[model samples]
Target: MTTPSPSPRLAGHLLVECLIAQGVKDVFGVPGESYLAVLDGFHVHADAIRFVVNRQEGGAAYMAEAVGKLTGKPGVCFVTRGPGATNASIGVHTAFQDSTPMVLFVGDVASDTRDREAFQEVDFSAFFGPSTKGMAKRVERIDDAARIPEAVARAFMTAQSGRPGPVVVVLPEDMLTQAVPDALKALPALNPPQAWSDPGSLRSLRQMLLQARQPLVVAGGSGWTPQATSALHRFAENWQLPVANAFRFQDLFDNRHPQYAGDMGLGTDPGLRRRVSEADLLLVIGARMGEATTAGYTLLDVPVPKQTLVHIHVDAAELGRVYQPALSIQASMANAAKSLEGLTAPPDVPWAEWTASAHADYLASLNGAAAAKVCEGTLDMAAIIRTLSETLPPDAVISNGAGNFATWLHRFFQYRSLSQGLKIQLAPTNGAMGYGVPAGIAAALTTGRPVVTLTGDGDFLMNGQELATAVQHGVKTHVVVLLNNSSYGTIRMHQERAYPTHVLASDLRNPDFCALAKAYGYEAEKIEETSGFAPALARAMARRGGTLIELTFDVQALTTRQTLSGIRDAKGH
Candidate 1:
């Protein structure tokens, strides 16, 4: 009998094997000397996976977070110790707040260098530990090369389980090069089991719905499968309920559907806000009523709501964390929506007019935003957004960072299709300013589709260096920059709102954005008139590499509805 060849494996190669077994095809990271072994492992498994070389650790983390949001699986990222880990913390915090599943692996100093404040060393647990407000769900370090499989599997589990968030894993430089038996290969990645609601809770939810005259359904958070989204549609259609998506998750429900009630987030529809407050019953599904969604908790009374609250969440902890619900169903979105779809709505329900009126208010809000013509300014934001809405494909991915510039697109752009089986939105619910560029790059690389990123001058500069990354990767995305020459638009708007025109730190000085983009290998131009946008967008759509369109927006044009001069002029009105 021929003897089986002795299995030879390095810890880094073993880790890659485990990741492949778990179905991870892409990983974003910056190259580091500490993880040179892991880099080689990536080369060894080149046919199976790709290592996305990001310009900065922060951008890499953001890309990973976007992947997690798009796939509903834990997005994986690799970074080095100390500064690299710290730089990546922003994406970790974003995943925490956004309820995304992600795993961050940091290569650390050699095991012998422990606790001496070695070069590029950090206390992983202390830095990424869990708290009421912490970046990671769990932080762990693996000194034993043989234990990598276990750690990888556990990281996936921890990230996907209860209130899905990020997990941190630390690997010592010396240990990564250590040997692990090839026979002890990694097990497949684990998935969190779908938690189902109790039958009694479903019965109670049905009774509560029967007792309502004005019931509104609000959906948000991750963990929503296509099946769940379809079931939610069925549940809404069967009961003739008006549904709204919470915060940045506008794609959870089809916007074109008549039952849609618009998104509840920054610059929420006033009509929708009023409807939410006036409704007799609030059916919250898969969303945590956080500060932004609830308008700093003012929309819903804290411990108790003015309206009857029925909160259905994947995690049991989020149920009673905010508004105490009249009925709380603890189940995964897929299971909860499935259960809800089966419940019988009473034939004599009293909320028909209420639902119809809610949808009417939503339609009015959209019409109002579209009808208002340009009060002033050559580069009219309304027209620009209108052109973009008309030109882009129905399934086009819309990527944006935080700014007043986003207000224009958020108000006018309507997402109508799911090209990649997920929402086209790649915005950060945590309000990270530099999120758009990298997110657009990630979306383009993963989906192989046209990606559009709308950004302000300040927001663009935050992670604009990643344009070099896009150029290197030959990524094709349309980047629209609204330049209001020398001021942070959102902060300036807030400064105008609170302090009235003493814009101190909010004033920004920017480079020639067109020249900058051209230098980075993009087709770019500057637009000064409303009529220039559609042609620029058309040219971008036809371009080969990528395109950047810079529009000169007046600083006075602060928002979709109001201007800075208008805000200051009204003063105390």
Candidate 2:
């Protein structure tokens, strides 16, 4: 009898093989000693896949999250245990909230040192437990190196299925060193079938549409395929329905379409809000009707809405989780939109005038008298944003973090269409500051598309160090930093509305951003006036290694409509 010789390949190498089998091309991470085997695997398979080195774990996570948004598949990220996992939690939370698919691999301490409180030992399962408010959808640790394929494949599957969220996989350092046999091949990822709309429910929806005088469609959410978007447009055009995007999912709908009603998010258009209230039928296609979308649940309260509610979603668990719908249809967005497109629209919907009014309000709200005047200051933000709209290409990516400075961009910019087959917006629904800089770099590096990032001073500084990552990656994003020296603009607005002039720790002493950006190898410029933006923007687009155009905003230019003094004077009467 002959003894078989053992084939040698590290478990970490097997994990990388599994990722390649699953069609992952790029991964983002910060290097760690615990994951040295995986890094070695990356080195071995360098040509097949690329590992994006990030400055910090948080930025890496954010980059992965943004990649998840750009590409429907789960965004892959690798980080070491304990502190690394803690830092990466922010992106996981954002992915959970935004319904984006992402998989985070945490390299952990050795198996023998688990209970003893070894170096950087922390219970990952306990920390990233699954719950409604939890960080990840699933959290599991792989103790056996042989099961690496099974574990990673499961993570990918769980991350992408149903509601689509983050999954955490813990890898023991000692397990990575174990040699696996060459016969052990990596298994391919399994994707679950999309839930199709019930024919009866869709028919019921059509009947409801026929009966309504004023009907509105709130279109949003992740995983909107091209077929789905086209189907949505056809459905909207067929019935002459007004479609408003949910929260930050503006790119899901064609914003330039006549049927576009406007984005229903923070600072909801007053007229649009009123029209939403006045509507007879609310066909919420993919939107979760989240807090911000429903104006803190005041616009459309749970159990039942003022109008007939047709709630359609991929996840059955999410149907009655919040608002009980008049008719609940369990279906993936593409299937539902495709089914709806198949339905015959009546020759006259009777509410054509009502629909037109809603869209009119949307068009009027953008460049109209009210909107233009709202951005009142020495440096007209509305003019600057509008200039950006005119200057940038339709396919150019626009990303922003949380800020009052974004209000002007939100109000004034008119998104063209997803029909162009490109993701045009990358704003955060979870209200994470410093998301823009990292997201922009990721987008630019990954897509090679022109990227523009809009950020306030406070927001930009959060992960602004990632600008080094951008420069290192040979990607240039036209960065617009609104220099409003403030930590809590949104909080200040609420405080003023509640307690008048009782300001508390909102003001900030910022650095010379222009000089800092220049030091970081960026073509930096400081612009205070509206006219200066065009030239700066043009130069940024033309330049090679990226540019940071700083807008010198006055501290008094608080909100879009009012100054700090005006807000104090009002005392929120």
The model with the greatest TM-score is: 2
TM values, all candidates: 0.96, 0.97
Q: CA lDDT of each candidate?
A: 0.85, 0.85
Least accurate stretch of 10 residues (summed lDDT) in model 2?
367-376
Candidate 1 yields a Cα-based lDDT of 0.85
Over the stretch 1-573, how does candidate 1's per-residue lDDT look in tens digits? 998976777898988888998899999999888888899999999999989998899999999998998888988999999999999999999999999999999999999989999998889898887776778999999899888989999999989987789999998999989877768888887679889989998988888888788999999888887788888888998898999888888888887788888889888889999999998999999999898899999999889999999999988878899789998888998898899899997666677787777777777766634324433744667667767777788667889988887877777677663322656888899999899988888888777778888888999898888888888877865555545546788888888888985779988778999899889888799988778788788888887667888888777777777777778888863
Model 1 quality (TM-score): 0.96
lDDT of 2: 0.85
Which pairs clash in model 1? Answer: 486-508
